[model samples]
Target: MSGQLVRSLLIALATALVAVPLGYFVAPWLGWGVFCLGLGLQLLFHFRNFARLDRWSRHPVVDASLEGEGEWDGVFGRLYRHEKELRQQIAQREQEIAMLIAAGQALTDGVVLLDLEHHILFCNRTAEAQLGLKIEVDRGQSIVNLVRQPEFARYLSDNDFSRPLSLRPERYRERVYAIHVIPYAGSRRLMQIKDVTQEDRLDQTRRDFVANVSHELRTPLTVLAGFLETLQEIELDTEERQRYLQMMSDQAGRMQSIVQDLLTLSSIESAPPPEDEVVDMSRLLDKLRRDAEALSGGRHTVELEIDGKADLLGAEPELVSAFGNLVTNAIRYTPPGGRVRILWNRTPLGAEFAVEDTGPGIDAKHIPRLTERFYRVDRGRSRDSGGTGLGLAIVKHSLGRHQAQLDIRSEVGKGSRFAARFPLHRVIAQG
Candidate 1:
C-alpha cells in the first residue's frame, strides 16, 4: 500500500511540474484559462484512477472498467484476477483437508500423524482413547518419548512402514494390537493401530488344537491297527484271540469317542446362540445324575442337589450335553469308592451348576488350559480313564453359546470343582 501511494505521488508531482511550465509559456499565445482548466482536469482524472486501483487491490476482484484505460490499469487488473482465483483454490483445498480429517476421526482404527522430525502433528479421537493421549498437551512432542515401547520405537526408526508392529497395552492385558506406520506426502507419516488380539489368539488356538487332535487320534488308531495286523499274521488260542480282540476294540472305541467329541464341539461352535425358553433345572439335574450313576457301573456314587427355583432358558440338548460331560468326567476320574456330586443353586445375579469329585485334583498351573482340546494335566491318567480330551472343550463352547461362564477350582491332592454360571436374565420360572 505504501509503495503504491509513493508511485502515485511521484507521477502527480512530475505531471504538475511539466504542465505548469508548458501552460505559462504557451497559454498566453493560445488561451490561458482553457490550458489551465485542461491541466486541472487531467490531474483530477489521475487522482481518481489511483484511488480506484487502491480499492480494487484490497478486493478479490478489480473493476473491469479499469482495464485498457491505461498501461498501469491493465497490469493491476490482471494481477487482481489472478490473485482472486488463487485464493479460491486455496479455500477449496482447505475444505478438502477438513473433510479428510473428519473421515479419519470417524475411523475405527486409531490414527496419528507425525512430521519428519517424529513429532506428533495430529491424532484422531480413536487414537486419543486407545493410546491414552492428551492431544493438546502432547502435540509437537516426540513419538519416541511418548510411546515407551521398545518394539514400537524400533519399528518407527527402521522405517518399516509396510508391516505393522504388535503391541499389548497395559489397559487391555488380554488383547493385542497391530500398529502400522505409513509414510505420506510432505515427509509426514500416518500411524494406525488396529485391535487384532482376538483373531490372533483364535488362529493360534485353532492351529494347536488341530495338532493336538491329530496326535491324540493317531496314537489310538496306530495301536489298534498294529494289534489287528499282528492278530492276522499269527495263530492264537481262543482266550488269547478274545483278549487281543477286546484290546483292539477298546482302542477303536477310544478313537470313536474322540471323533464324536470333536464333532460335538464343532457343532456347538458353528451353531447360533440358543433361544430363551424355560427349562426345568431340578428335573434336568436329577435325570443327568441317574444317567451318570448308571454309566458308572457301581464304581462311583453319583449324587444330585438342586437349590435353584429358576428355570434355565437355553437349548436343552446343549445344556444337558455340557452338564452330562462334567458329571461323567467326574465319575471317570474318581476312584472306585470315590463319590461325585452335582449341585444346582441360585445366586443374586444368576443360577450355577457345580460338579465336584473326590478324585485327584489338577495342578494350579494347568487349570487355565484345561478347557483346550486335548490339553490334559496328566496324559496317561486321561487316556487310562478313556477321556477324549475334548469334553471340557465342548463344555466351553456350549456354555459360551448360552452366554454362560465356566469356573474351575482345584488343588493338588484334594478334590476339584467345575461350575457353570448362567446369567439371571437367562433363567426363568418354570412354566
Candidate 2:
C-alpha cells in the first residue's frame, strides 16, 4: 500500500477503537441503539474519504501533494513542462502573424485575399488605390461582381491555383499590370498585382530595333553586290568606269555611316552613365552650326540662337551626337535656300534645346512613331537624303540616358520643331 492508504487505515483503526470502548461503557445507560448509530456514522465517513482518494489516483493533478515520488514525480514534471512549452510556441506563432500583416500593408504591390466562394476577404492599401476598391464595403462581396472584367471572372471561378491571370486594371490609365492568384490555405486564396507597362514597351522596342538593323544592312549589301557584278561583266569607257566607281563609293559610304551610328548607339547603351562635366552651350552650338553649314554645302542657311543662362553637365560627345543628328536632319530635308535655326534656352522647368527646320513637315499621325528605328514618313525621301533612319532613335536613347524629354511639334505644311528638355539639376550656371 502507498503511504496515503496506510495513513488512512491507521486513522480508521484508532477511531474504531475509541468508539468501541465508548459504546461498551455507554450501552447500558443510553441504550444499544444510540451507540450503534454513532459507530455507523464514523464508518461511513472513512469509506467516503477512501473513495475520494481512489478517484484522485485515476485523474492526477500536478500539485504540492503530488511531489517526492522519486520516479513518478519525474514523469509528472516532464508532462507539466511539455504542456508549458506548447503554450509558449502558440504565443510566438500569434506574434509572427501580427508581423506578417504589418509587412503586407507596407508593400507597394497590390494584394487581395479571397475565400472559396469567390468573395473578397481582405485587401491591402495598394489594392484599394490601384483597383479603386474599398475594403470595408467590398469585404465578403463577390469578387466577380467587383472586378467586372470577363477574363478575371472566369479565372476566379476556375479552381486551379497553379497559374495566375494577368490583367490591366481599368482604374489606372495608360498602364498595364500582371496579376497572380494562389491558393492560400483551407479554402482561401491570395492575389498579387505587378506593374509591367514599361517592361512591355521595352520588349517591343527591342524587337523593332532588331528587325530595322537587319533591313538597313541588307539594302547596302544588295546594292554593293549588284554593282560589283555589273562592273565584272561589262567592258566600259574610262568615263563610264569612273561613274560606276563613284556610285560604288557612295553606296559604301552609306553603309559605313549606318555601321558607325550602330556602334555609337551600342557603346552608349553598354557603358555606365557618364560623369557630370560642365560644358559651354554657346561654344558647342557655334561649332555644330559651322559643321552643319559645311555639310550642307552652304545651300541652306544655318542660323544659331542661344538664350539659356545655364550650361550643361554630361558627356560632351553624346550631346554632340544628339544635337548634330537633329541639325543634320534639318539640312538634309530642307530645300535649298530654306532656313534651319537652332535655339537654346533655360525655362523655369528646365533647359530646352530646339531645332526648327523649313523641311516638309511630318503629318500628325506619324508623329508618335517618328523616333522608332527605320520608321520613316517618306521612305523614298529618306533614302534619297542618305538617312540611316537611326538618327532619331539615337537621339531618343541619348535623351533617356540623360534623364531628358524630347518633344516634337509639327504641322503638315508648316515647319517642324524638335526640342529636348533637360532637368534643372543637369543645368549649371554659365561661366
lDDT of each: 0.84, 0.82
Query: Clashing residue pairs in candidate 2, if any?
Result: none
Q: Please report, as a residue range, the 10-residue window in candidate 1 with the lowest summed lDDT.
A: 60-69
TM-scores of the models, in the order given: 0.72, 0.69
Per TM-score, the best of the predicted structures is: 1
Q: Which ten residues in a row have the lowest lDDT in candidate 2?
A: 62-71
Candidate 1 residue lDDT tens string, 1-431: 46555765676666666666767777643444555565576667767777776786676453445552445565667776787688789899999999999999999999999998789999999888877788899999997887787887888888767767889877666878899888889699988989897899999998998899889988888988888898989999999999989998898888888888888888888887787766778788779988988989998888888785778889999999999899989988888888899998888888899999988888899999998888888899889988888899899989988889999998877889999998888877543
Tens digits of per-residue lDDT, candidate 2, 319-397, equal: 9899999998998988888899999998887799899998888899999999887899988789899999989989999
> Which regions of candidate 1 fall more than 4 Å away from where they truly are?
1-92, 109-197
